[model samples]
Target: MAARSGRRRAIRGWLGKACTVIAAAVLVSSVGAAAAPAAPIHAPVLRAPAGGYEELWVPSSMGPIKIQVQWAARGGGAALYVLDGLRAPNDHSQWTSDTDALRQFANDNVTLVFPVGGRSSFYTDWYRSSSTNRQPITYKWETFLTRELPDFLAGYGVSRTNKAIVGASMGGNAALVLAAHHRDQFRFAGSFSGFVNPTFPMWNQAMRAAMWDEGQFNVDDMWGPAGDPAWSRNDATAQAERLRGLPMYVSSGNGMPGPPDLPYGAVNTVNAMALEAMTMTAAQIFRDRVAALGIGARIEIGNGTHTWPYWRQGLANARPMILDALGAH
Candidate 1:
């Protein structure tokens, strides 16, 4: 009931913000060649593939993004295009090492394409009115992956027809948006602990923080002093209902109420409280409204914060559902 109610609030909130997204998610221009050169992309340390896991990198328009391939050691099956999290570093990250997923899904005979290197572009092209997202101009990542990665995998023996895309955090939003906009690309999509709303005030704040770190999220560029239109379409909440038939898996923490301790010390008491309240509220909002839309989805809630340990566990819990969607043994 709580989750259901949370979904309602989210829907209302999203509906209210959709108009803003139209303006906020405005495509200004690509990272013009006139802009400073993009930072050099570093390659990930190639880790040894366990059993079915194979290490490789696929060519993308954005350059060569690293990929960890898990080939079906047995016969042959489907494919899963896994997306990474926000804090994905070159050395270690979720897409690079699912840890248990390879061993767990080996018998399923599916190929896993774990691509890395889209730091914060949300895996979308950005030529300011980009052909893909038609919003933002930080980078042109979306075109490279959706257009190129699949072909690369197909050449390597990953079945194109049975492919599924799943991700966490920002990547989840990408998975949802990509799947919704291009249903032909994926048969199923999953988003765990995703920052779905690009236009939500909270999401707006997060983008500001991320861009501020990279010297990109100027207050003006983000949303033009709040209430920006383009911002909302960038958000998952605003477009969640648009995804009708895609099998999506969306989950978030219960936003356990308490003072969250950072790697250092307690600096944000108020923010933590707000986050807790908001997460709890958003979960319920998504639950009810999405269910009403008749989209096949699975929602999980419990006592966990927005951390990788929790996501890893959640993946295990939902692995069966993934297999079910893929029609695997």
Candidate 2:
């Protein structure tokens, strides 16, 4: 009877200690909860551009992206989306910086939407599980450009559904892909010196090299392996059928020095020549494929290299066609 009484007392003492520990844990949790700080604000900010353009930071899954827009002269019923080249700067659009795009379109009755940044992203969605060659952030640009940005711009009197898309180089490639995939949103598409047929032999290697130069992004993370189906799926030549009946303009240079070429001894001109040569080959393949598909498109080949001057010329050449398609006065 004495042993049983001792055992009962020990059990009761252990239960008392367990309760004390539980109470201590509860107290700590309550204190910590009370001391927790409030979450930080992440609202999008808008700033007016010095050149009369309005800039807005659009919130997306990939965080807030900056968009520079020149509101329409006649006020908001149509829009033209002008995309950047391979080396897209984070500050402003090349259209505004390199050329007189804004001043030229100042009187045009269409909002010129320019998405800034995205150096080597090609403005498409990425599947990045590894960070060896690319960043770990999510790239849902296809969603941002097609849906999120349009939906947000609607509140600002911009017509969400009525729009035309144009791009140069990398942006050119993405513009066609986006237009082909989402035909309902874009009525006209233009590509100037863009590498359109990326699935061609040795093209993926070139792309990888360019990406490494720009941001060290992985080609595989972009759409998957070179042999992956996405390579062909993203190729505009492969999807030429979808672009049928869509008003399109395709332009590229022969990489030879012309009016817009830099001085003969300039190394940048030599580099431009080499780059545009590759672009011409790919663009020709795409143009031929589209022609074979019975898609009537305006294709222009000029004696120029891959420079901002040539791109500006191409945009000026395609402007009337784009405005006509959008019925913009």
Error of 2 at 53 (Å): 1.3
Q: Global lDDT of each model? A: 0.53, 0.70
**RMSD values, in order shown:** 10.9, 21.5
Backbone collision tally, model 1: 30
Residues forming the 10-long window of minimal summed lDDT in candidate 1: 23-32
**lDDT against true structure, model 2:** 0.70
lDDT of 2 by residue, 8-30 (tens): 11000001211121000000000
- Give the distance in Å from residue 20's predicted Cα in candidate 2 to where it truly belongs: 70
Question: What does the lDDT come to for candidate 1?
Answer: 0.53
Highest lDDT against the true fold, candidate = 2
Over 4 Å off, model 1:
1-52, 95-99, 128-138, 214-232, 257-280
TM-score of 2: 0.83
TM-score of each model, paired residue for residue:
0.70, 0.83
Q: State residue 213's C-alpha deviation in candidate 1, in Å.
A: 2.7
